[model samples]
Target: MLMSAAHAQVSLQDRRPVLKGIETVDDPRRIPRKPAAKKSKITVLRGGRVFDAVSAAARSATVVIEDNHIRAILPASSTDWPTEARVIDVTGETVMPGLIDMHVHLTYPDSDANIDEQGSAVDGAMRGTRNLRWLIESGFTSVRDLNGVGEAPYVLAQWSADNAIPAPRVFTAGHIITGTGGHATERPLTPTHGHDYAIEVNGADAWRGAVRQVFKDGASVIKIASHFAPDEVEAAVDEAHRLGLKVTCDCEGIYTEMAVKAGIDMIEHPLPRTDATITLMAKNHTASVPTLQVYQNVIDRNGGFYGSTSRRFAMTSQDDFDVFKKMKAAGIAMGVGTDTIGDANKMIPNVYIAELKWFVKGGYSLADTLKAATIVNARLLDMDDKIGSLEAGKLADILVVRGNPDQSLDDLQKVDLVIKDGIFYVENGQLVTPRHVAQPLLKPSPPETTK
Candidate 1:
């Protein structure tokens, strides 16, 4: 016999459910060795024009990094240099904060794979690990995985943080939360694959519990889908905000309006939204990710429609593009995300670059597009104070590219170097495994010397 939603709710509230496979331990021999003790080192980058993400243009400057944080950004003419610092000369290059992708699905299969043949959790893990490499190589130092199969994304995030894998900083929403048979829940249900991508629930109370479940499972952000009752979404937003996590919704039309009104922090796509919905989003300061490239890909692949014949959603590429333009014009805060789930190999650099190009095509300057990808996206992630810009006392996630990206958007393709957490992940246009260094343990000063 199957359990009813009401009965399931009682069980969930009685005892927290642990995510499947979270407690499994890997073989000791397969575990990567712990990081070596951290040693402070001073490194200076000289002769490169820097785009601090706060400035209108890249200017000649010298950046000094101490350990894993930026110690200073000195003027080009200043000569007060640290004597022991190792300096790397980057004459004629552009140095800036590493790029961020506000949305991604790291567990999805390659573009050529059939959608119906979704893989197992182990397959998702392997696919995600491969995708992480492509992301970092393309200069994305951090990404937020909006959804993934089972516990795959969460496990991958932990692995990336532990330096057990060569990957970017990862923030993940373990599984999307949606109403029963809702958007992300449309996948074919089988015994093993059921609820792999999203959890289905009914009623406002169940909605709140769903939020708690994902939060307890180590989700850094909450992702919910629409076609839900107004009260249900409202309960979810309230619960997530109470837990100190921001909520992002994947919705269109009336659903979008409801989410914005319910205080959703972010909306996922540039799907059709009314003028009133746009106004409300701007007024409420709700940000949008406007994943234009993915929708455009759909149109291109389907001969001008945004969806297949059976699920057309009655929208077109131009329709979505127009909504994106209007949202930008309304002064709504927006970020960049490539909702490139399939064909990532062929789609990544192109999709990500195309998204920025669309921004420029819609009246944004080259510098504006760069900021959208850096600080603006960082702010959306609530990580602006730490990783967004080339500022002192910020994490050393810097990127050096061959040309002036602020002047020519295409120049961003020339990724010469990438530094995350002061570790060199890519140098001279080549990927290298960095030696992990763990922070030294602080010991209590020997019992205050009885002076």
Candidate 2:
């Protein structure tokens, strides 16, 4: 009378699977305009050990990318290849989700070189083109730019989307909103503090205006300067949500407490938060991105060195180290971020490992720290469905590190390869870009050739 689940079938089946008794048309002319041109040819990556961040053990697996997304994760034994398919042999490496850092000042460089004088129409794009490879070489495949210094983050992000740059997928908040004389408004040099154009809103009304302004200018998230007042912070979050953007804050103590109450989406800091503050943050689903690396790099100016840039940027009593463990114990969400600027003199490939090392030193288990940087950040980005793990149908945002991150967080410093958006940016810890200088090339080059 009725077909059982196994017996049910479709008529005139093609290569594609059936959906609800309808089969995808095999006729080229009949296929839809949107998907026909971009149909993927399978690319199989074989002989790789997997360190799927969510999984407990490293499995030998075959990863297949179809178009821009991962199509399948096959077992070690499955070698069935489609004709004309490309195969990548990763004989000895570990594959895991690409790293995610929530707080990055994309506009900053280690030195004071004028990148402005050096480039074409795409200043940020060019800088990103150079730096993206550096990030990938250090095993990062995604970053959340906390601030856009020179209108560069957007170009880099768009170029990455245009498949022009071999960098990690970037989600950026165009600029940070700060009160007229807020911490974000303060600058290191000059007798008179300059207004941070990044965010120069005055009050609740101005905060409300920035929500729409940031989105129109191409921000996926809205950030508000909150150390000034809790009610002021709440107003911005409320306004940003109506326009459809997640709200993040850069503040400490009561600023964070009020933001949690206001329903801020995430907090960016080393979390100068207390145990009570951590509990409230957890209850409110507020995530924290401890840009500890940046803050830790805070050199003491009063100690006869350069001014502590981190201390200058920080607000309130909570910006200390103890807050991290208390927050971790209280079960607050954490994401990876390195506010540190890097280049040749720094001797660091990327700031991510620096952030991870602190988590290990600060008493988080290695696995938890990895989860914070990878899975947790993905979840915060609303990209968990696409990149957090080696899941099918997700984009192949992955990295292979030198040692097992599961064994120790310190091993994270040794990078192996970085693959983002199904493109290889690095292999064997070397940037795939042609020989170029990381120092002088932080400006736009000819888009046609550099790409």
Candidate 3:
């Protein structure tokens, strides 16, 4: 059997073996003696102010994208582009790296009515697919799903990577690993919802096993819950690191201290932490994704505090802001995440914008806030080297907004264009059909007979 070059390339890019029972021909004679040289498809954005995500400023420049990687970022005056390059004039626009969201739950319902409903896998898949499209259309080219329901996230991740669906690049931590009756396991386990949101395991060895299980299920990162012994957290962290992955924890107060001590790479929330723990986190370079917007939503929807009986009642929005300020003053690495579980259409831009505004309110400059959403969030995902900034040799995941977002984050909502992996998904502030979807799917070549 023979496979097309395109199919073989996709397999290699995925770092997975080809499907079973389809053996590729190994005969040298059957291969082309001299394959035709492929021409590079070049697209240039001319006369745009480029914000590369490194400097805290945008400069007038031209970006030359060749295939799926940036070829160069030339000066606005430079006309040194290939004659075949398709140039698009982007004067008065801002071209920057695509944004990233470090924390999201794609499988969760997008509305209040369905929030507590026990949906099946098919329902979860539908919701997740819808969320993925909303994320990409909103200028998020990459996202990390911290706790997805069942296999929905893993399957979605694969689909997004293969361009089988229109979605941002997805990195997921299959299910939350927690002790019995821990943070994520609070809901009653029904037949449909049992162990889909979280897996309750006990003991240090059990934590290690949970880490291994999620990794086997194609999770690139590990998410663990709090209220566990120090040794258990340590075991989970060690197992994840050994597998060449990072572990983040969703815990507060003493649990935060324990997770940090266990060498957790990131903390999920801006929960109350002692000054000593903050110092330790800064010293150890532990990253944080303070999902302040989610907590604020809880308070707002429930009228003031999340009710007097709720554990979160004591923590006010002001308290969340104060904790963020402290973390910033301590030089803790922070990223952007909304943790939105409402109507994506109504909540995405609003929730995401609110998160950025909170960062500004917490003493981050507008430029720095944008960085947190792009390169900084990429660093949190350990993917900065590939897709964080707009630079030569990086993936061509770029965004062009109508106004200067570095000066005012509100202008970020004007997403004029978005390009992921060199394919245009959005243009003129509208979503377009992806190239893969518009074209016929690649098929394997028929086997050739030996002469």
Q: When superposed on Cα atoms, how far off is each prediction in RMSD?
A: 10.0, 11.8, 10.2
TM-score for each prediction? 0.85, 0.78, 0.85
Instruction: Name the better of 2 and 3 by TM-score.
Output: 3
Off by over 4 Å in 2: 1-36, 111-126, 187-197, 299-319, 341-350, 408-414, 433-451
Better of 2 and 3 by lDDT: 3
Clashing pairs in 1: 111-343
lDDT of each: 0.79, 0.65, 0.79
Residue-by-residue lDDT tens digits, candidate 3, 1-451: 1222232111001111232233211110011234325569999999889999998899999999988789999988999888989999999999999989888888876564443473556677888888888878889888888886778988998888776777888888989898887776564433223467788898889998999999888888899877788778877887787776788888888899988877788998777889999999998788899999888887687644532111242577888888888889999999999876555434777788889999998888888999999999877776776788999977899999999999988888899988988888889988887444355559855669775
Poorly placed runs, candidate 1 (over 4 Å): 1-38, 112-118, 187-194, 304-312, 434-451
Candidate 1 residue lDDT tens string, 1-451: 2223343111011011232222211110112344456676988999999999998988999999988889999999875666988889999999999998888988876654544565567888898998888878878888889888878998998887765776777878778888877776554433222477788899989999999998877787789976688778888887777775788998878889988877789999887789999998999899999998887877777766534211237667788889898999999888999975667445667789999999998889999899999999988877676787999987898989999999888888999988887877888878897556878669855687787
How many steric clashes does model 3 contain? 0
TM-score of 1: 0.85
Give lDDT tens digits, candidate 2, residues 92-136.
Answer: 766778887666655455444454442222544555566665666
Worst 10 residues of 3 by lDDT: 7-16
